[model samples]
Target chain A: MSGAGVRFDGEAPAAGEEPQSTATLAAVAEAAGVSASTVSKVLNGRSDVSPATRARVQDLLREHGYRRRGGGARQSPLLDLVFHELGSAWAMEVIRGVENVAREERLGVVLSESAGRLTPGQTWVEDVLARRPAGVILVLSDLSADQRAQFTGRGIPFVVLDPAGDLAEDVPSIGATNWQGGLAATRHLVGLGHRRIAVVGGPPTMMCSRARIDGYRAALGVAGLPVDPGLIREGDFHHEAGYAAGRELLALSDRPTAVFTGNDLQALGLYEAARELGLRIPEDLSVVGFDDLPVARWIGPPLTTVRQPLTEMAEAAARLVLDLGRGNAPVTRRVELATSLVTRSSTAPPPGS
Target chain B: MSGAGVRFDGEAPAAGEEPQSTATLAAVAEAAGVSASTVSKVLNGRSDVSPATRARVQDLLREHGYRRRGGGARQSPLLDLVFHELGSAWAMEVIRGVENVAREERLGVVLSESAGRLTPGQTWVEDVLARRPAGVILVLSDLSADQRAQFTGRGIPFVVLDPAGDLAEDVPSIGATNWQGGLAATRHLVGLGHRRIAVVGGPPTMMCSRARIDGYRAALGVAGLPVDPGLIREGDFHHEAGYAAGRELLALSDRPTAVFTGNDLQALGLYEAARELGLRIPEDLSVVGFDDLPVARWIGPPLTTVRQPLTEMAEAAARLVLDLGRGNAPVTRRVELATSLVTRSSTAPPPGS
Candidate 1:
């Protein structure tokens, strides 16, 4: 049973169990009542079989458990990276870029994810290592500190995507310039001459959120504006949290005229809150967000946010991983990309006096 | 030098290789001039490190070539699995789900990809067994028939997704009930009173295309409409192909009032073509597409498409791979999932009469 991310611990085929052929092509064709050519195509990965015939042949093969050769002989790749929660395919965008570099280096990535809450954690790393995968990429965000260390301590070559902490250098790390992006967003709002500016972001402890806060502070300092910490609030980096933050800010006596959010998903929540409060965009409040994900364009008025090249980031990380597999030494490189604020209909000068 | 996706071959360690001490918590703490708890917290993947300190520690460790484990253990997971043309984390959708299943079943996947047409027929399969991955996923489409057969025949326990032809029973296969899905799409158009219907499909030789064409024919038969060969056309399942098909169909004297495309990517192409030709969606000509991907909803006039639960389908495929890995009989299970027809602004009773 070969699964996408499953790893086997047995030896490659010892000096023994070298040659085993279970069924002949002629036999499978005869049993399935198909011609040799038809069987040959089906067996070859050729797509010329009728659905009925395909189904019948597949049935026969499955029932008889007929394997032409009893042993495998292909040389497997050096690394496999399986990510979890890649549902929307957004996660894949990065891996795509990463795979290109990995291929050149002869590293293989078995892309797969862990189940809900039953994360691949320790067991996953151990199993993958046994297969002798040179390194691993955890498309992760919420791993506890201990688990990360355990994997690192186990001597597994691994990197975490959007990790919750700054792991050791032996483990390469790549992420967006959240702080710069935050500053860009705040500057965009401040440029509109808004005095009462509010900031909504994810939990304060998250590095991303902290970086955004730093950017917000920098933008304020550059603007000669006094930073009122009271205007800053934290959410869960989710739409609902954004909505709550939006509502709270809007209800304040000295309500903020402009707001900067940490992520697009959070920006969406603000949009909903505005609608709920009977407030129109731009006319009532100017908003900006970060991580211009694909859906950013679909939200009402098309969000004006800072962009993060997620694919590039993923690719860069993948390249680093592949380089590690190739026995190339990587420096402790922390790249902070430039962030640009995309202006859209969602932001405009604060409405009348 | 270890990186993501590296594999350990259990080869004998080189002579005179001295055992090295893993960076202990105390050492890292002393090296960084921080408290043991602080280093411990950082190493354990906890959240409390100040940005400055964290970055400093991480950088220092990398500069020193820190290895978390002393050299006794064998190097872990060196095997890699290369997929074909799966750009972005988009392909990871399958990988993640597959990984989850594989992890549970104690397997590891090494992800990789092929360039242009550089795959070495079935020779790669031989290489895979030699490297000793318990199983493989072929990714099905990227490999040739010979390669697929080589891997499968060798009992590598591969579960082929979107198999071109039929296989015997013991080999696992997973894909959508494409024929039924196609039928549903055609029926929707017919019920909408579209008589002069057209078809835009991928390579007709592909099973998915054939199933949809069959469904379209079935709907026409039920509607008592004769199939016009000229109104039907084949495509390469690309945007360009769909655009060409749409252009050709629209030029016909008896233009199709509605068209059903085989794939979402192609459907998007058809949409672009219709717009270029100034043919309004439902207002000018009805266009329905298959594979209701996320992009469908963002179009100016949201596309009317057949929604294939791609994520769910991926999950199912992943599960099948894991099940097979667990020594479950290789079952020829054809999970026929029902596709839903999503109606939006794109489809309407074809332009007047």
Candidate 2:
């Protein structure tokens, strides 16, 4: 408690400037009133340190911008790929992408799930520090500022894949052009004379989903069609959510002729809803989906979707983290890969056109 | 080559007996004409050793049945889960299963794909050796006898999940009752008054497919129906294969009224083929699938299939391997979980009945 506000010998760099005076381990230890070995143990993620002491030391380390130099040779030949949750073919594609890079680099991939949380647990960060992987790639997951400082202090680089929420501008992230994909999907349906098109957006909390809905609204505006609030449904990105939302929308007196489910899994749910309502695809109801997961092509009538290139995005994230680990700064910290419209049998002209 | 057949100072254990008098590392090194440090390097998967020397040293270690004692402290907190090919909802189920066990045990999961190969590559084995995971869980994949010997020499334990091919009797494995599942599937179709039933089995090389087909045959035999050779289609367990087989089977002059697709993906393919032919599910034709993947419930008509309990099976495999690593020999090295029939809207009485 006495060391809480003590000024350290090190200073943090100015915004947008490279760190010029990273304090050594001994300086941080002296300022925190601990032995250098204690600071070393904390950096190594040893569990022997008490939570109170660990937090105090971590705060001092961050305040001093203390980064260990030349720890690359000591790093384990591994990369951590953390996910918010592990379900669906979407994850499988991402896993394959990371596996590709891991194989090429001869590094083992450590797979962990945050168990549906937006960020990994404290224990996960501890385990990661102990193993000391070359880098980390997070999919739809973020870290608390303290957790971020912990990794930064250890010289461990991380890249976010498809960030679920707003991130600091300094954090490197890879994403698809979700807004553009949404616009293209809506424009395609509009071109097919579907004036009353419905949009089933994923969880509004997710930035990707929000961007997509914004694009949907933009497309309608560009096409000179008034955006109908009644036709927009907010649903979680899952099959059940899509099913419930679909059932409600289809049961309306004036239902839309086409529906744009935010993702492919939700689109499948919508498919079931349409099936139960005796609606034949493209005949009575047209549908579009995003992600273009492999199942998108296998389902009956095949889904018309925006190809998000999930695997490529994952590969890019893996590469970026590795590059950062090797001290190779990227030209840009934020990147959005191209998303293309894939036309299939699920979309058609409005009935009796 | 002079070290090829030279007998070392170690005696292999008798069949069905525990190993006795395990040779020392120094003895193996001397027998292989290498220094003890070189032999230790080989054990640690260090790449400095020449390939020839590495193979020679490994052979000597296996001949001696050498086991490193008290290396648990040095082992990384990891469990390796290798897949023959990372695809589909099937792999996802298995990954989730292993993750559950790993999370509880406070172990990190290292995932690898063999890229469609029945066995993982040599490089993968070397990396696994270097990482020294607590245990290994292999999915639909096998290892060469030499590879197995190497792991055994290092006191590493592994378990197979859903064995794709024949395995040695002593090899521990976890699987579902594929034969019984097939029998139940066919019996359900028969009970629905489908006398002319077609069977679309997975690859003949996979023991699961063979067992399932055999069960189908047994069910038909018990029902006093002759096994129609022309109605059995040998296809791989994939959507495209199902589509091709479905096209062929449906094109028969006297097409079968119902089909038992070996897996869910193939069933989806069959659905596409049926839709193309203007046949409605459960009315014009009946369908059955296996594995009971999440998509099975989401697809149109909600596929009637066999629930293989893949996640449970994977959990069992992971637990078994961990138990083995702790020298807790299981009562049996082979375990098969039960598979049950999940009846849905995909089956019905004959249209003319």
Candidate 3:
């Protein structure tokens, strides 16, 4: 007898015989006396399936061995959330956002850190595919062509959160308006009567970082000010990079009166740099930061910053991935939440202006 | 023919028939020409199983339908990590520590925030059980007796991180030496000649918070000073509570020369209170905080605080749970890592000393 049809009859199977292939969806549908589309809907966890119909389809699917291709036997109820690292309050905000949605849906979340690496290793994909989660949400990371194909082949759905690089046209992604955040931060400084403003931003090649810098340039252009390459410093969106860049700008003979950083960590570093030189905030230098992390409000002089809705973006990504997992297409391929300027105590008219 | 013994023969099955219970481990082992213990070891993912034997056993187990009890069909490779909240840098530190260990073990982590609630809802347990994670790690939270019994019944392991309440004698947990941290913080202020010291601590019902307050009282007793009831206040270990408590202590007829807070967020809040009252740190009022989170170093004048190794605690909890999940009993029911005093810019002798 072929091994595929062997059932549990309280009798032992022959030694060394293995099931060759899983049964087809069509066969499972026929056995359940339901249309193939209904079976497909049930498999995708669509809400339209009645409870009785869903139960029947599930039992038939189990009996006929209709598992996802290469995904062992059953799909896990958890969703995989992958991050490049988990060291900052920024990550905590994103995590909270995802947890909010996950709680509502009663789905568990699996978190993976890529160990400060931009891209997840090949083994990461292999492990995820093996777990066969209901969906995936990747933050500031991307998948290789091969990895994408593997997930697609297995019918797994994934959504990107603030992707660090360009994504395919069809890939659903959630992010904030980095360009608007940068523009607002720069404009706030410029509005404070600062003529010589400097910008310290993240890695030059990172999409979000580039967009912020572009926005800074656009703001300066709109104000009829010439863009000075000397005032634009590239940082790694970290405190050390911000400190080093701040020190460089401060040491210059013609230092700018105002500075805008790509993120809050860098802005704090700039504050240290300014402190070391006995420069008073607002009186000596006006500073603006992005991300508006919690510490921004608690600093000596609260930081004026552009608030990126990281939590909301994370929630959107989670919701979108869940929708896609349930066989529903996204309403839009790319979602950009709004960014707003929070005026705290860090910014003022330039010194002696 | 009996439905259980039907052969594949590329034919559809008759309707309305269901498969029986999955094959037992004994049957799987017999088919694979191995001992039952060998198959059990493979199922538990123990390191003792040889690759060749494991592969053969896995194939046989698949053929016989040997799935984990109540785990649908497969056990997910993820570990559930639940927290009280994810709004603070402290939480981030813990997450980083867990990620470090999880990465080394080649396991995925699932994060959940209980939204500042002490206990997870009923659905939380149901969802976790449904996912069938290898293990679970809960931070500053506890499971109900029923929840614990459910996990135990399903053969899933769980470890508590910095549990707020007393645990069962046999439950595994990881925490810091809160009493020592408190003593060190209080002793530092005492050594600086601050006799009139005040304490702002977390909820009295929390074990760690109570330990810290006791340590504070211990340090005062060691110095032959009376523990003034007026100088001790209960807080929620949050910024707002600190600010309010600081204002109360500062407004006292006989104000304290120094104040020690339960956590860094409260310390920052005290800083604001001091600022509003035109008090200069160290010069006018000395402050000490606990849990030297990253913000403690970046804040103005930095903060003198007790350093609780949250990351290490999380790592230990991860390791302990992984061991438990593999059927290994913990070497100890409770693990307490060391805490140390990190002196920075925020503490000094009383102004008149």
Candidate 4:
């Protein structure tokens, strides 16, 4: 009972209780008078299974206590994708990626938002368990220790996307090369001969934001330039924060020639701030952003920024979770896709260059 | 046998066959060995019910043929919100509204995309029925007669938001006042002394678009201005269409001083077209858009447009459907919220005036 492939009577054993007999797939199929593949299909909630046949197979499985290796019921034909917030183009990009894969796998995707919190409340876990989705993908969020254990105990696979905090090595996660993205953005500005550069970053607590700021500093260090403490500002990753940060940076006695933002929304706000002060982009103040969202190109003086492959990252997370759900272990627990710089009209040689 | 609240034994009666006895709430509670409130909560999939207790109550309900007044099984405490596409800020606004109400009600939301089709495919209904959500809200889409009947037969209430076509009086719907919105936009331009106003509207087949175009014509008639056939263009409601139409209109020898677009995305494209042709906003060409989205203010020279209360409309739709799920019929089958003009930097007196 302590080993894999355990079985029991009609009633599921109580938590912490071990059963005696172990039921094999072949044994269960033989007892149910069905092929092993048919049993598997029923367990996977495939649509091809006839209602009566599925009911019969489910009853037989329950009676034999045929647990699928680990502890949990059959996987429902749905996947849950939770986001920190669902009100941005960035979220839409990730959703489209997940939907592409989910559609191909004939799985429905459920979208949830944590309502601007770091993670969903305790009831979110209960809801996920009740639905029994095939897997869960949480973007910019993490599960608590207890929640993680519950999912592990139930053999529910979950993958984190762009985790907001330090992720344990054992946890499966997908993210972009934030450090390299930051380095690349700063290097591009350096190449344009702008030594006086300012940084407008996201929450000081977020891991990704810290990584990006570190990259910016690393670039400066490599260039043998001094890091100006007054030039760095940290705030939430939103437009209003960007506007405020930009105003402060622009009002400096010796203002920086270029500004780098944590994300594109902030870059837009910076544009507003500059406009209010009667400054022209590229000519008066060069600006760079990250996350190269769709609107990055649509905005006036198409933004030059770091391109994070949001869609690809989401797709990878979806694929990894689905593979795990299919009883296949991941080759690696952590996957980080590359990021690059997208040069547009927003950046040019600094004033008086 | 055919009366309301009828129940049967373990076997569900064949379609068209009616049962003789109706299992009362007391009988279901007694058989399941739970209080009436507990049974009711279990039937509604309330989070308060323990898993074991819920399973027991569900089994008993099936054995006793106990169901709500309508034909379907108990609600799943989940609501499905299907969108034509989830790749826009507009969708996000609606989702936020629905989530606000759903959070308060302690109901989970399931978001789905119809993938740009007019309606979800045939299998969508089956998949939805399998989940057994309390109700469904469709944005800019409609169900066929057969699909509507299927939901009706299953006791699942559905409401349409911003319906793309003519909805039957019996179908509940939520929409903005498109005619009034269009009227206000055109009147703003007319009041600015722009007699040669050009209209870039959406597809002729969409009812809302038609209403908007009609409103434009009505405004011109009220001002004793002749409708300029040459200035009217109709296409899909998107950026590319607006850009193409703007180019065509601007290419004309007798170009209008101002242009009014069906939506904000199209308005943005018009801005690009005007910029590429060396025209300045308000100074050279006044532009008025509809659906004052978030970007309307963010764009250079904030767009003067019609305010379509999308979030409020979505909230209203969600509230209506939840009421229907709770056995309350809507006070009105169709609800149209008000739309108003938002004057910003985009519109001004025609250049010469």
By DockQ rank, best first, the candidates go: 2, 3, 4, 1
- lDDT per residue for candidate 2 within B1-353, as digits (tens), equals 02221112111112221223234676887898888778777776566788789889888876776666644444567999999988778999999999999898778999999989999987888788877788899999998876787788766789999999999887899999999999999999888888999999999999999999998999899899989999999888999989999999999999989999999999999999998999899899999999999999998889999999999999999989988887776899899999999999999987798
Report the Cα lDDT for residue A93, model 3. 89
Question: Which one wins on TM-score?
Answer: 2
Better of 1 and 4 by DockQ: 4
lDDT for each residue of candidate 2 in A2-121, tens digit (9 for 90 to 100): 212112212111222133423456677888899877876677666678878888899887777666655554467888999998988999999999998888887889999999999899
Per-candidate Cα RMSD to the true structure, in Å, reads 21.4, 8.0, 12.6, 12.8
After TM-score superposition, the amount by which residue A341's alpha carbon in candidate 1 deviates from its true location, in angstroms, is 4.6
Off by over 4 Å in 2: A1-23, A34-38, A45-56, A62-65, B1-23, B34-38, B41-65
Q: Which CAPRI level is candidate 4?
A: incorrect
- After superposition, which runs of candidate 3 have C-alpha atoms over 4 Å from their true positions? A1-74, B1-74
Q: How far is candidate 3 from the true structure (C-alpha RMSD, Å)?
A: 12.6
Docking class for model 1 is: incorrect
Please provide, for model 4 over B90-209, each residue's C-alpha lDDT reduced to its tens digit, 9 standing for 90 to 100: 788898888877776655677788888878876576666656667899998899865675466456789999988888778899998999988999999999899889999998868889
Q: After superposition, how far is residue B225 of candidate 1 from its true place, in Å?
A: 4.5
lDDT of 3: 0.80
True contacts kept of 2: 0.50
